[model samples]
Target chain A: MRIFGLRKNTMQEELKHNGLYSRSRQALLLLACFLLITFLASFCLGRYGVPLDELIKIILSKLFPIEQSWTSQMETVVFNIRLPRILMACLVGCCLSVAGVSYQGVFQNPMAAPDILGASSGAAFGAALAILNSASNRMITVSAFIFSLITVCIVYFIGQRAPGHRVVNLILAGIMVSSLFSAGTSYIKLVADPTNQLPEITYWLMGSLSGTRMSSIGFVIIPMLLGLIPLFLLRWQLNVLTLGDDEARTMGINTNLLRFVIIICSTLITAASVSVSGMIGWVGLVIPHLCRKIVGGNYKYLMPATIIVGATFLLIVDNFSRNLMATEIPIGILTAFIGAPFFIYLITRKEKML
Target chain B: MSLTTQNLSFSYGIHPVLSGLNFSVEPGQLVSVLGPNGVGKSTLFRCMLGLLSGYSGRIMLNGLEISSFSVRELAHRIAYIPQSHGQSFNYTVFDMVLMGTTHQFTPFASPKKRQIDAAQMALEQLGIESLSKKSFCCISGGEQQLVLIARALAQQASIFLMDEPTANLDYGNQSRVLDCVKQLSQNGYTILLSTHNPQHALFYSDTILALHGGTIAAFGVPDDVMDESLIRLLYGMEVEFMDAGKTRLIVPAQGRGDLCFVGSHR
Candidate 1:
């Protein structure tokens, strides 16, 4: 009976529906604390290696009048180099993961990820196109962001015009459009010089947070917020929206409009994150699933938990990517290497993944 | 307020699903829709719930047209109970029921104490409060149906539109769900339930609206409109009305000549 889902939750009724939920509240608090700790530790990492005490004092100097004892090199490493990259890593992870959860909710498909609507693929095409033309990194990011938005818009329009279940149509249209952009990227890569342009295009496609500057964050922050803020605000409607179209409509949701908003917001996050970080895999797909294990599957907890865990997951992965060897490993490769085995381990365990 | 549909007709291109249907369901009446497969019972419920907007007719909730009301206003007035099915994620029973009260709050806001209390009260009313913390997908089909009913109850709507509420349920669960629905009508809640069984309609419903080929076959109290001929017209089968004390049962007619033993089997 226990194995077959007949297990009765025996926690006292007075525990505020206590079994999974109260435990998740505690888990969320613990994860937040852990994220804070990791954030501090990341500031001290890298070849420059600022000591923990110096790191704390330097952080405190911003608030109170603490004497700056640390050298200018440490300051540069913390503020100029590590700070931007670390924040970029965390933000990109957070955005993509949240966008993944939103897409899954919107499409009601568990396999849905940040690129379900072709945002990342479209960004890739833009990045590849930029690299072929020998454009600057800033131009590549701009091109990627613009094309990503355009790709999702095209998918949405085609999805609406196509006949069938809207969710199925949208998903199929996403596949069609994503393949189209992916082919474009392939063509661009083929035409580029094998010496310089090819390597650059290939590396960008592999996804990295290397050379992340404050300006990179500056370019993407607005669209990311435009996406993340609305998703965070519309968290509750998520539960109803996942019930499919007619069910959601009868539940008093304007299913078309809600789907549109979720798609747009999630697309913004995906495009923004991919423009800077390239097509980072698994952070968006796996983080939400992991968060669902930690917290229950309710969107209220799952969404926020994904945000924290995503930031933490990518930050740690970036740490390993940068520090694991002399040459920086591509973060995308590290994610699949680390994420897939861990996910296999998770699924092999007793509890259900969904 | 009563729900009335006037010449409500809908089609998929030239393929008509429901056409020129007119019926009225009064307050606190348990109206069971009985039909054969593809008789547009589902389509009728869809039109009534204001889901199929392409339909050309007026569906009035009280005095106002259903189309004139906002989605929130319609939800406040009528709760829809879809058949229990699997979802991509496993939300808790409490979370499932809490979804019904979402119309009372904004999308940006989480469920507050008022919404929680309503959801709890609904579960309590259905006597399934103990299942609150359990995974919805883990529960039995019966319990899932009950949870959906509890969800509809939490919506605080006077009218309920259920689409094949017992489609995949076992006989025991089907009766249990129908009994609960019967109790709701007795407690002064209006309910529109669609089912395949004429016996369930006769025993549990106050009125029966039978549909055939996208049109009304019969619409009235079961006592006045239900019989063997009507069943024959609807299902194209010979059935007899067998008396079972107070409630009559629809049984297949005995002694079919084709089914007679003509072969060598002793």
Candidate 2:
């Protein structure tokens, strides 16, 4: 009987090993190479007709001191517009996806997204209120930052104090607070000065990379990168946290402290993303799950894959929004247009719910 | 070598789960906790491992208060295998077991070579070394239980607190797990485990504790707590204790005479 059991276990083990090897490592390598290629392609393909050779030459010139008569238009297209937009997309995408991944692990729910817990709504309300009160642009960002922090604090209190402290209750509280704040935002929009601030508010809510300037890039990049620093440093603790709160505590981790730090970090990441990009949707939610399906769930693997995939995904979404039609669709609309269908495909194609 | 409790009590909201529960164990002794389902067996283990808070209790391990030790220090002293875990989403078996060595690692440090070897040894001890690469959720329930127990063993703690380690196993696996528990005890690890199976308690434990209504009902030798009246009180049913040569068994009083006669004839 023991011999039979051993033989059966070995056969089962071999089959599982084959499946894991075939699916995980190759998918990871392919996704990594695909992200790199997409980033380079996004850099090269644009309205200014920079051929791949000139693009590579321009890139090499920038890196090394190669002499070439690069036109002012080419320089402006490459360095000023395309580079900043791509960099912003990469930063915001990476930030949002990392936040999404952390939140999913912390909450242990696959449906969790970056904005699901009122972070984006809270930031939007802050930005809108800033517009209402004639606050400076920088101060508008600060308002968004502070209010997003407040939203999470309120949600945490409500969820933690509920009867069972259930994950569903937390999610419900997030939706409740989110809708409430969004309604408040609508009210602000209703009463704003239509001639001056209305277009600003409308465009801000629509989310765009059209206004991608180097200064604006620095504004969001600095804080978002700072917010991501802690996550990178404590990445392993994040993995341990996925084992659930009780198990994490039993493993000699102070689960509450780690969770509090994570909430602050991811909130900062999310708030910074919204403060700059004005609420790009679905990249955070979809990118991490896509990466997880491809690379398995170890955060050591999941984190880097998420960064690269998020960058590539947003770049692609931006490309579609830019050239797919005569009029530029807002990046948010394109994200939703592409994201919902792709997410549906993922859900349908998935054999098991993670 | 000794763990002693002084007037330990725990409550949730207003209702107490364990009140004034006192017990002690020395090195190399296997202790069994027998109680009905909701009699605070799991809670008691949680408290002993310092997982639950808001409890007024004094649990001392080797002359030190349990609460005084850091979580890592406490984990080094007492390892636990919980009865149930919420399903993991495709975490590799090796990663699941490697988590046990988190206490040994320097917070963010990855598992060292020695720790990996230790985890491998623990899996081998449970006869599941081949499961190291399998997704944890894809394995059978019994195999999962073995992996968890193997993880607890990898902790290398001096004391083991197991909450129903054999609760979900089939008879063959149950016997194997119990034999492992016995072997651990013989190697001078003090073990206190809660179980629903009286036979496991009888066959493996050197000390038996029976709890009822948040208090200790019977405590001492297997011969003392394994009596019909105490077992009936603990389980709230009539049970007949019978001895056949060196083996002991408990059966319901009224219906199972045929099986008993067959065993007697055998």
Candidate 3:
């Protein structure tokens, strides 16, 4: 008589777990190629179109000495215009998705988005306040980032002291604090000049990468890397965190410390992403979910997969936002348009809840 | 090879849960702790695992205090097998088992070849390697319990802290899990398992420790320490002892003649 259970081994299982790795690895490679293609193609698909050959020469000129076959107009658009925007789209996309996935794991809640801890709302209020005060663009970004961190700090402090399950309390605190900052933003919008500051605040609130310059990348890359690298390294702990707090602690994980670090890093990434690009939605929430569908839930695969898919997805969406109409569509609108429907499809198509 | 807690007392906001609790578990013994819900069984386990660090008194492993050891050092000695996890991710059984080796990894390092082999060996030891490729959420309750135990085995720890390992299983699965647990002690692993069922302790435990009212109710060899009064004290229920060939059973005393079979059971 069988004491435990039946054993019928699959051939893939016989491959000593490399099969899972290989499939995810192959998919990641394909997605990386796709992301690269999207990156290059975004450089070529603007209103003042740079042809593929011209785009290639423009990129190669940076590496090796080449004759200036491209016109000054094309050079200005590529170097000062499209390049920064493309890089910003990719960086913001990657950061948001990574932060989103990290928050989901840390909180053990699939519904935990990048801004679930009030970072975006804080950044929004900061930007609106800055625009009202007539602060320069750089100071606006800095203010947004600072207030974003400060908002999450307040939420975390309150959440820690709230009398219930920590995760639930944190989420509840996030909702309340988010509304508080959003109300602050509404008040700032109420008093600002409608023609200039009000429109600027409104447009920024809707999210755009339109004015991203080379300097913008320099501002964000440091904090983004600071946040992203630790998250990438701590992907293993992210998996343990998903098992809940007690089990993770028993597995020798310093759960509270690990969680604090994860929260701080995720907040850094989210705050930086929002500070520059306004509040771009859906890429963070949807890209990770899509990656989970492609690769299984193991963070080892999911983290890298989300990075590639998120960057590619945002690049493609940003391209459409620019080229779709004479007036550039705010990326926030496009992402919600694309992201909400796709998220619904994912939820409905699968028997499992993501 | 020994775990001893001396005058270990814990409280939540001044309402004490476990007070002056003292017990020592021997090496390679399957010691079952019988206790009712909210009688501080879980709180006691938390204190022992070092999750609740605000507790008073000392818990020592072998000879040293548990608090002195690093998290990794403690994990290398004592493995915790939770009843089940609240996993929303579709991690495979192999991935679930692989997490057992997290304690061995240095900071920023993922599991390597040595850890992978350990996880594989753990599944093989439990004879559940076939389930390695299956999603953890898709497995049966019994199979999930075995997988959790396999994870503990992968930790390579001598002591296992299991709180109600069979509390959620079917009758057949419960025995199967107990049989697997019993075999672990035979193989020289110290196990401290908590249960609501008294018979499980009588049949499988080397020693039974019953907790009630913030203290040790009784602690000794299961057969010698257990009686009708003790059962009543622990569970607040009436039970009669039925003598078997070698062991005995605790059956609920009195009849249900006042009530019908179909009344508001659930």
Per-candidate TM equals: 0.95, 0.90, 0.94
Each model's TM-score for chain A is 0.93, 0.86, 0.94
Note the residue pairs that clash in candidate 3: none
- Give the runs in model 2 whose Cα sits over 4 Å from its true position: A1-30, A133-140, A160-169, A193-199, A346-350, B84-88, B255-266
Error of 1 at B111 (Å): 1.5
Off by over 4 Å in 3: A1-15, A66-69, A347-350, B254-266
lDDT of 2 by residue, B158-227 (tens): 8888888887778887887788889989989899999998877887899998899999998898977688
Which is better, 1 or 3, measured by TM-score?
A: 1
Candidate 3 local lDDT, residue A170: 93
**Residue A184 deviation, candidate 1, in Å?**
1.5
Q: In angstroms, give how far residue B49 of model 2 lies from its true place.
A: 1.4
**Model 1, which residues run further than 4 Å from truth?**
A1-20, A342-353, B257-266
How well is each residue in A17-107 modelled by candidate 3, as lDDT tens digits? Answer: 6764687889999999999888888889978989999889988999999998889899889889998999999999999999999999988
Q: What does candidate 1's lDDT look like per residue over B1-266, in tens digits?
A: 79999998999899999989999999999999988988888888887777888999889989789989888888888999989998888799999998999888776888876777788778989999989989999999999999999999989999999988988999999999999999999999999998888999999899999998888989999989999888999888898988899899888898776665678376
**Residue A172 in model 1: shift from native, Å?**
1.4
Docking quality band of candidate 3, CAPRI definitions: acceptable
TM-score for candidate 1, residues paired by index: 0.95
Q: What is the DockQ of each candidate?
A: 0.51, 0.26, 0.47
